[model samples]
Target: MLKFFPEEIEFKVPQVMKTTKWIKSISESNGYKLGELNYILCSDDYLLEVNKQYLDHDYYTDIITFDNSEEEDKLEGDVFVSVDRVRDNAESLNVPFETEFRRVLIHGLLHLMGYEDSTDELKLQMRAKEDECLMLF
Candidate 1:
């Protein structure tokens, strides 16, 4: 199941058509069955606060994933996305809003699948996997 929890603020996200498809594809490709996936769209301020509080980082980030997967076959997580950052990143990356938005969503799912981006090489691999997953959309 997939659930959306929009914050008090509203930001247009077109429709989550491709986003849903891409998420399912990524989860399946990683050999896990998705259970409950929660999406929270919030302002940059809210996400930044989460980053600082939970991650001990003071910088703004596009997305953060809180993995709650209990078993190898089950996939579960809370994907917190910053609509503000996504919009700006889309413009900077020269991609459509939906495309960049989906990228960030897949990035979070990748984390739940045990992918990391803490190092330069890992970030490159993660980006490659993200591109591969995006192409499947």
Candidate 2:
């Protein structure tokens, strides 16, 4: 089961369709019998605050995933995505909003799946995994 929380925040993201597609693909690719997953799309300021508070990072980022699952096969997490950053990155990368947004969503899920991007080599591997996952969409 997949759900959106709070029920108040209006998700006007144009890439929502693609994001859903990508999420499903990730779940399948990881061989996880997916359970409930939640997504919260917010502004850059909101995500930056989350990053600083939980991650101790003062910089803004595209997305953050909080895994709540008790087992690897049950994919459950709260994914906080910055729609504002997605838009900015889309413009900077010369890609469509849906493409960049999907990329960010996959990036977050990969983190939940124990993939790290803190180092240059790891970032490359993560990007490769992202591309592989993106191909499933």
| C-alpha lDDT score of every prediction, in listed order | 0.87, 0.81
Q: Which candidate is the best by lDDT?
A: 1
lDDT of 2 by residue, 1-137 (tens): 66554323466655556657668777877887567788788888888889999999999988889998888677888889888888899999999888887788788778878899989999999999989887887
**Model 2 TM:** 0.86
Find the 10 residues in a row with the least total lDDT in model 2.
4-13
Per-residue lDDT of model 1, residues 1-137, tens digit only: 77678886786555666567667777887788988999899999999999999999999988989999898888898999999999999999899988898888889888989999999999999999999988888
User: Which portions of model 2 show Cα errors greater than 4 Å?
Assistant: 5-9, 13-21
Q: What is the lDDT of residue 76 in candidate 2?
A: 82
